[model samples]
Target chain A: MDIIVCVKQVPDTTDVKIDPKTGTLIREGVPSIVNPDDKHAIEEALRLKEKHGGKVTVLSMGPPQAGDALREASAMGADDMILLCDRAFAGADTWATSYTLGEAAKKIGYDLIICGREAIDGDTAQIGPQMAEHLELPQITYVRKVDVDNGKIICERALEDGYERVEANLPALLTVISDVNKPRYPSVRGIVEAYQEKEITTWTAADIQADEKCIGLDGSPTSVKKSFAPEPKGEGEILEGTTNEVCKQLVAKLMDKNVVR
Target chain B: MEFALNKEQEMIRKTAREFAENEIGPIAAEIDETTEFPKDTVKKLGELGFMGMTVPKEYGGAGMDDVSYAIAVEEISRVCASHGVTMSVNNSLVCWPLQKYGTEEQKQKYLIPLANGEKLGCFGLTEPNAGTDAGSQTTVARKEGDKYIINGSKVFITNASQSQTAIIFAMTDKSKGTRGISTFVVDTDTPGFSIGTIEQKMGIRGSVQAELVFENMEIPQENLLGKEGRGFGLAMATLDGGRIGIASQALGIAQAAYEESVKYAKEREQFGKPIAKFQAIQWFIADMATEIDAARLMVYKAAFDKWQGKPYTVSAAMAKFFASDIAMNATRNAIQIHGGYGYTKEYPVERFYRDAKITEIYEGTTEVQKMVIAGNLLK
Candidate 1:
């Protein structure tokens, strides 16, 4: 079996200070890391490899520095690592990112494609399905439990209420959540070996045979017209009285808001 | 014991868990197997202010309390021990010293870069002859006019090869023993300063560890840390803080191991039933969970003490010793639960077992920790 995991490098939000004057994210001192959810996707791929004995390849698209995330995936346990980086790929929304990643995945044929439910930066939860649509592959989203056997893939997906058990044939895509498995810590020897090894492969837009029209900002369908922080809720009114009076006031407020029938 | 974490601590814990699970966990084993350093990951950690968790905001650090630092270390280690150590060394050993003893200019120049992750920093004290006995180091420095010429080498220094700056300890007055020692901040770019061979380590290999050789290395007088002859105290103080970080790392490793074991036991079948249904397997999980909880409490207590500006040396030592021991035990049991598969490279528990052993040996050996705790109690 061959598994491909898509990962992304994103600026850690806590470190991302907004420039008030420009209303833009301050990228100067902020460090870009592998998007937290994407890691679950990588782990799921590794898990599939462990159970079915297959090759695990990790693919990511970002700046030249995003190669670090690929190298990191390699260090963890990825059999093959690729960085899909190019200047043309800049300023991409989720649509463009999925398109680029989908094209790259198509180039690297796989029995299964895995990704995190969403990237932390965007939180759109659109990339997995978009990539699936682009690749024209069946997709399983919000996977909590996965079982691979005899070329058949079974997954339990978290839904609004409980969970949904789904089955798909080989060559499908899976977007995972954190509860799937706890990731292993890199050992000292793993660190040393990852440092010494040169397994990360870099690819540009031309390398993946992607059309110029469907590659970056031009290819993207969605664009953020404007971004703003959520408005703060009004302060609560204080009711100073005996316990019964306070309870009555709270009940009245709840009724006024239709929270209590 | 209350299992509930406060809002802020819980938020930090959740964020760290999500980051570690998503970012570091998948690649941790590969980095360990190949000994690769995740430079980008380190930079990301710096942006999160993890590299300077305890340093004040003015110094380009996170300005977080010590408990938050411990939480961060535990969460990171839970996914990748190498990154955990790298984070620990940066936040506690390198960045902490500068924040505490550095002059305003020193803070602006060295601490800023180190804290921001633009530059990596290392702490140097151990020599070939000095591991546990760091005060017996042979590295020396001689004052000449406006500069101090340093000679000799430091061994087994974490982040030495990659660090832009190193807070190094050297003896200035040989006759005064520990009192003669002084600390200096040396730039790795100095003509006479060079990194030696990287050591082939058993675990935590993602972090750079090598010998730092200083041959007639010239440092400006302003680079001297604190007052002359205060190096011993400074080093001790630094280690006190470092112990908590190591303890947190141990807690993370233990948690990872225990969690893996639990999952495996529930899934793997033997004797017509999942091993988790067996008494023996159930007992092991119970022990692992109990010990991990205890270790977490100890580590958090030490971090809390430090955050409160109280003396935490004894608590830190105890935490380090106990947590590291628990890590080793948890990893061993996790492998045992996997049976034969656990011993192979195919299983991560074996690697966790191997990696967990070093936590007891470094950052003040478990034996040394006992001595420290006992000695402090006696005093």
Candidate 2:
């Protein structure tokens, strides 16, 4: 089995800042970390590799620096890593980003593909499904449980009310939530080995054979017209006096505003 | 002139960060609150090859570089300081000594099991009467024919109760003071060997700390580590590497605290605006970030030096001192930034604040680190 785990390098949201004038995210000096949910996805891939005995490759599309995420995957027991990085991939919305990643996955040719349910910064919940559409493959999103046997992928999707179980054929995409499995710490030795042995394979848009018109800001359809801080709501007026008086006043206020039927 | 981390180092940082965030972060408070050692998690770490970071692959270790070891320590410490110490003790205190000084038979017997995480190990150096004054240790070892009879007690030993093996320092020749001290690898199952009471600590409570008593504990001559009079030097060398782990641990704790504070500042509202919009809060965030970055650089430099097999004692001391102090300060600022909410245990920053103080005291005290640095400068 060949599994490809999609990862992203995002500014540690904890350190993210907003540009006051442009209302854009200020990324400078913020440390970049692998997306939290993606870690669960990688762990799932690793578990699959261990049980099924196959290669696990990690793929990421971002700036050149995103190679860090790939290398990280390698250290955490991924067999291989590829970074689909280029200036052309910058500022892409979820649709364009998913399309490019899907294309890269197609080029890699994997039996399974996995990704985080959503990136913390975007919170779009669109990338995995959109990638599945682009690749024309079945997708199981918000997957909390996954098991592979008899050439079939069985998963439980977390829904609002409860969960839905689905089984798919080979060559599928899974968007994992953080509750899937606990990711393992890199051993002292694994860290050293990763430090000494792993190299991230970097690919540009040309390398992935991506269409120029389908990437970056130019390829993205949605653009923010304006971004500003949320407006504050007014504080509630306190009703003072005896409990009965306060209750009466509150009722009268509600009646005056026609809040009570 | 390449200042950037190579692919492997980069991967180590990434993997550790991910693991810390996904596995260790959520449970840190619970474990700290319960004072329970994360045994299952530690076992998982061992299976992942974390137990013997610097030990050679031949010894069942991952045989990674010093940078990786430091990075792992930093990452684990970022989420849980107790786990970080467990890793450090295994890598720096237990495995490193065996690799450097143990004979082939001893290495096979001790290092392999320890590196494989099949067994837990600890170092017995600090005692009730001796800490910074390690040479003043009163544990005595008397040679009797083919065996040595050891009698003494070690206190405040991390991982002591749960550990299967311990490398203990005992004096063979009382007249020679430090030079008379020698190290011996002791199996916990040996007769007359018993673990004393577990210490109630202020922080890193998830790691077990206890007293080890060796009363007429007999061990074969083959258990000796290195030369007869090299225990002091061996202990010092082990601590040099250990300090790097401690520095990284401190860096992790501080980084986590700073990150939590930043997140809270941005989301928390006051006076019709996010608190982050206020200059006072922004300044606190800025200082925390700057300090954490500086501490990270210092720790990395020390780790890099250790990787290169250079003399990193002074650098390690400096890194440990600075990083631990920064951790304390960063957690303090994180609490202040959160205001009343920070005071409550409902938030993680309060736990971080409680956890950070111990970093300055253990591995080496701040005063001790300054002394080490100054002594190196003078030399």
Candidate 3:
């Protein structure tokens, strides 16, 4: 089983700064980290490899600096790392990113594909499903639990109130959530081996045979008009009385605003 | 002239810091209060390839450098000195000597497990009568055919109660003085081998310190570490590396104390504003930060010298004494900065103060370290 994991490097800080004029992230001076969910995805891939016996390869489509994220995945026991680094892949939105990653996946070949449910920096939650569509492979998104055996995969998809169990054949993609499993820290030996011994295979848009028109800024369809923190709403009224009375008051106030039917 | 850690070393440091903060930090105070060995975390450290960090890969170690090992010890000690010392004794005192001096069979039987963290190992050299004067150790091992009958006891042995294996130094030929000491690998489960009194400690209570009694304890002749009568040299060589670990431990303690003091100074208010606004508090923080940075560099340099295969005896001694002195001073100032709260158990500075004292005493006293450095200069 050759499992390929898609990862993204995002600014380490939670208070992400945006360029007011450009309507893009102000990334200078900020440290980068493998997106939290992407790390969980890598950990799951390694866990599956350990159980099913196969190579785990981590793939990312970002700048050359993204190689650091790939190396970190390798340190977490991934067998191979691939960084799709090219100036042609810059300014990519989720759509172009997925298209490029999907093309790289097709070139690498995989029995299983795993992606994070979402990157913290880009909370669109579209790349995994979009990539699945590009490859025409079945996908289980928001996956909290997984069981793979006999060339089949079973996953528990977390929903609003409960969960939905889905089964798929081999050669499937899964977008894992944090609840899937607690990730393991990279051991000291693993870190040394990753940097000293392992080679991170770099791929370009041309190398993956990606459509040039469908990559980078030219490829992205959606552009942010503006991004800013929303102002806090006015203070709320405190309802006092029994629980039922408070609930009635709340519903009456919500109805007055037509917030809910 | 480069002060930065390499990529590998940086990764190791990051991993150790994360592990120390998340896994060990929460339990440090609890374990210290209970005096219960952090068995689970120690096992986790083994899985993280920290137990035998500096040992070679073929022997089930992480095959890391001495600086990386020191960084790891520092991080662990920053959160919990007990765990730090446990890891230090294993890597520096036990695994190092075995890898350097043990025969193929010895490596196979003992080094592998100890390095892999499957079994714990302790070094036995200090006796009740011999502390700084290690040359006067009265424990004797009489050679009898294929076996040695060891009839003496070692006191203040770390990990003694829990260890499965020990590197025991006994006077095989007392008539020859310190040169008569021979090193042997003795199984703690051997007949007539027993753990004596477990000492109640002032600090690092999470780690056990006990007396090891050997009454006619039989050790296999093949278990001898290096040639006969060479134990003293081996022990000294081992301490040279061990001091690096102790220095790192002290550096970590100082770092913790300094950080705590800074935090308290900023949050604690005495006058119209935070205590940090005062010049007195500012000076303490300044002095602590300076000392900690210097001590860290000294510890790292000692570790680097050892890694470069340089003669590190005097350097290790220098690092040990300097870092430990800094640790004591830093913790003292940390308590002073925190005022009454720092003296209480609520703050970890008091614990740091207690733990720092041991670093100045164990491995070698500050006076002993000075003697080592001066002795070299004089010679």
* Residue-pair clash count for candidate 2: 8
| Candidate of highest TM-score | 3
Off-target runs (Cα >4 Å) in candidate 3 are A14-29, A229-261
Give candidate 3's TM-score.
0.94
- Model 2, residue B351: distance off in Å is 7.8
lDDT tens digits, residues B53-106, model 2? Answer: 778899988877787788889888888988999999998999999999999999
Candidate 3 chain A vs. true chain A: TM-score? 0.85
Q: Indicate whether candidate 2 or candidate 3 has the larger lDDT.
A: 3
Per-residue lDDT, model 2, residue B55, is: 84
Number of the top-ranking candidate, with DockQ as the measure = 3
CA error at residue A151 for candidate 3, angstroms: 2.4
Tens digit per residue, CA lDDT, model 1, B301-364: 9998899899999999999999999999999999999999899888788878877998998878
Task: Write candidate 2's Cα lDDT for A1-261 as tens digits.
Answer: 899999988879988877867767887888888898998999999999889988999998877777766766676788888888788888898888988998889888899999998888778879889999999899999999999989999999999999999999988999999889987655555455444677778888898888888898988998877767554478879999999999999999999999995
**Model 1 chain A, poorest ten-residue lDDT window?**
A185-194
The model with the greatest lDDT is 3
